[model samples]
Structure formats: structure tokens, C-alpha cells
Target: MMNCIEAHGLTKQFAGRLALNNVDLTVGSGRIVGIMGPNGAGKTTLLKAILGLTPFGGELKVLGRDPWVSRDALMNDVSFVADVAVLPRWMRVSQAIDYMNGVHPKFERAMAEGFLSKTTIGREQKVSQLSKGMVAQLHLALAMAIDAKLLVLDEPTLGLDIAYRTQFFESLLHDYYDKARTVIVSTHDIDELQHVLTDAVFMDGGRVVFSCDMTDFDAHFHEVAVKPSDHELARTLNPLHERHSFDRSVFLYRNADVEKLATLGEIRTPRLSEVYLATISNQTLAQKGSPK
Candidate 1:
């Protein structure tokens, strides 16, 4: 499969601070990847670089073209829903469709209208008149109507109710997703997206600390809930992270002996949120211990 995005030694600096530091990443076609990180962790910077919205150092390519130099050409095959408010608040639903149809050659006006037809939003309603959830639905409708190879969504459903958020993802899966296209979403709602994501990229302190396919997650990481009596035995395994949960100690291990850990306590697959928290915690501890 061809890679939709490729980066090697990709670096971006803002003023005197590093926003993206020597990052290397590859996103292949036909996969839904979730980019997770805290604020100022380079998630937005990386997306900007990919979308050619910002200039950056090092090699980077989107759809086999340099994002900086070939942005216009690259955009022909890429669509993005940067945020819920990207669309002009003054634009009416009909005008939004007309504008997209006129601007984006690949945009299908009928398809966008088709999506809107299923919603409560009316063609005469202005974006400013719609609720936050309705705005997200409008944006998603426009994005999904584009015949693009790669789609990038950054907090696409921010400030929406759970029902709307669930509808947004469901629409993506049922109406837009296909084997030939790729989707990359960056959001704080990890648990909500856990089932939707085929792979995950965890970033911290302007760098990617971990990236893995969801299937390989269990092979690389393990989580065990152990009793106080087994804490010593669990400690001998050198867990990446540990924390107290009610009466048990939850230990996170990386490439550890699962069979041995089974003897410690209940061993089960860790949720994406659990793995992400443990990974960030470990990174924080390592940074603190490093010489300044």
C-alpha cells in the first residue's frame, strides 16, 4: 500500500520554542489513525505541516508531493475539517454548498445536500443560527462530500453533545470511509474514538513517543490489576507505570511476560486511554530524571 503521508526529521519551531522536534512519521492509505496528545504537544503543528498551513524544516510529503511547495496540487487529493468553526458564520447552508462547489473541483454539491437532508438543518439557515452540534454536522457534510484520498480532522466535533459526536463518527464510517481512502483524526476524546481507530500515534513534548497499530498494541503493552500482596512480584517485572485503583494496583508493562503477570492478578487489554495515560506518565518521569 502507498503511504499517504511521509515525514523524516520533520521539525517546526515557533519563535525560540520547538513545536515539532525531529519527528518521523508515516501514514499509509486506507487506515483511520488517531493522533493523541496534550496541549502544546505538537498535534496541531504536525497537522498544519501536513495541510501545508505552516512552513517547517526537514522532509515532509503529503500524497507524494512536498506540502510546502505543492500545497495547491496536494490539496486536490486531500480534504480537511480543521475545526467546527472553519465555515463562515455568515454563510447560509445553501451558500456554503454553492461556495464549496465553486471553489473545490472535487466537491459534490448534491452529495453535501444529501447529507444535510438527513439532518434538521435547513438550506436557508445561516451557520450563526445553528447550534454547535449543527455546525459540526454541516462541516462534516461538506468534508464527506469531497472526493479526496486523505481526510484530516482536528477536533472536528469539539463542544458538541454526545449524540452529535456519535452521529459525526457514524456518518464518517457509514457514508465516507472506504478501502482506498485514509482518515487522520486528532481529538481529546480517546475513548469515544477507540473503536473507530485502526492505529494510534501518541505525541508528547513536541515529539512522537509511541505509534502502533491497534492489533499490535496488546503485543507491545500489557496492563495488570494486582492485589497488594502481589505488588512486590509485579515491581520485579519493571512496569512502565503503576497507579492505585480502589483496592488494587494497576501496573502497565511494556513487552513484559504476560504469563508471569497473569500470576500477579487479572490481566486484560488496556483501553487506549489507559495506554495513553501510562505512556505520558512514563515520559514525564523520564524527562524529570534526565540531566538538565
Candidate 2:
């Protein structure tokens, strides 16, 4: 598969503070990649770099073109829905469609209208009058209507209800996704998107701590739940992270002997959220060193 995005030694700064620190990432085409991170973790910065909205040091390319130099050209084959607020409040639904049709060469008028027809949003209704969820629906309609090879979404469902959030992703999966296209979603809702994501990228403190295919997760990580009596035996194996749960202890192991761990307790595949927490916590612990 061809790479949709490539970055090497990518670094970004804000007012002399590093926002992206020597990041190297490659996103292959036709995959649903979830960029998971907390606030100020360079998630938005990386997206901005890919979209050519910010200046950075290092080689960065999206769709094989330098984003900073060919942003306008790159946008022809790329589409993004950053936030619900991206649409103007005074614009009516019809006007938004007209504007997109007029400006974007790849806009598909019938497809966009087809998506809107299923929603409560009406052509005459102004953006300000619609509910948050309705606005998000409109944004998704517009974004999905574009025949772009790459789609970038930055918290596209923020401030929406659970139903809307669920609808947003379902729509993307069923209506928009195809093997010829790639989608990158930056979100804090890891568990909700875990099933849809083919790959996961975890970033913390302005750096990417882990990036791997979801299929490889089991090979590199494992979670074991043991009785309190087995805690000492489990500790001897040097688990990456451990915490108490109910009356038992849960340990997260990285590249450890899974067969050996099985004897200690019940072993199961860790959720994406658990793996993210373990990875970030371990990085912090290593940086802090053993408590003296």
C-alpha cells in the first residue's frame, strides 16, 4: 500500500516551546488511523502540519507533496472537518452547499444533498438555529461528499451527544470509507473508536510514544489479573504497570512471557485505553527514575 502521509524528524515550536519533538510517522493509505492523545500532546499540531496550516522544521509530506509548499494543490485531493464551529453561523444549509460546490472542485452536490436529506437539517435553516448534533451532521455531509483521497478529522464530534457521536462514526464507516481512501481521526474517545481503527498512534508530552497496527497489539502487550496472593510472584516478572482493581491486582506486561503469566492468573487482551494508559505511565516512570 502507498503511504498517504510521511514525516521525518518533524519538529514544531510555539513561542520557543517545542510542540512536536523530532517526530517520525508514516500513515499508509486505506487505513483508519486514530491519533490518541490528551490536550497539548501535539495531536492538533501534527494535523496542522499535515494540512499545511502551520510551519515546522523537518520533512513533511501529505499525498507525496510537501504540505507547506503545495497546500492548495494538496487540498484538491484532501478534505478535513476540524470542528462543528468551522461552518459559519449566518450561512444557511443551502448556502453552505452552494459555497462548497463553488469553491471545491471535488465537491459532489448530489451526494452532499443525499446525505443531508436523511437529517432534520433543512436547506433554509441557518447554522445558528440547528442543534449541535445537527451542525455536526451537516459538517459530515459536506466532508464525505468530497472525493478526496485523504480525510482528516480533529474532534469532529466534540460537544455532541452519545447518539450523534455514534452516528458520526457509523456514517463514516458505511458511507465514506473505501480501500482507496485514508482517514485520520484525532480524538480522546479511544474506546469508542477502537473497533473502527486499523492502526493506533499514542502521543504524549509532544512526542509519539507508540504507533502500531491494532493486530500487533497482542504480540507486544498483555494484561493479567491475579489474586492478591499471587502479587509477589507477578512482580518478579517486572510488569510495566500495575494497579489495584476490586479485590485483585491487574498488571500490564510489555513483551513479557505470556505463557508464564497465564499460570499466575487470568490473562486477557487489554483494551486500547488500558494500553494507552500503561504506555504513557511507563514513560513517565522511566523519566522520573526509581523513587529514592
Give each model's clash number: 0, 0
What lDDT score belongs to each candidate, Candidate 1 first? 0.91, 0.91
lDDT for each residue of candidate 1 in 1-292, tens digit (9 for 90 to 100): 6699999999999989999999999999998999999989999999999999999999998889889888888888899997787789999999999988998999999899999999999999999999999999999999999999999999898888899999999999999999899999999999899889989999998899988898677787888989999899899999978989899999988889888988988788788898899889889989999998
- Which parts of model 2 are misplaced by more than 4 Å? 290-292
TM-score, per-candidate, Cα-based: 0.97, 0.95
lDDT of 2 by residue, 239-275 (tens): 8789888999899888889889999988887788998
lDDT of 1: 0.91
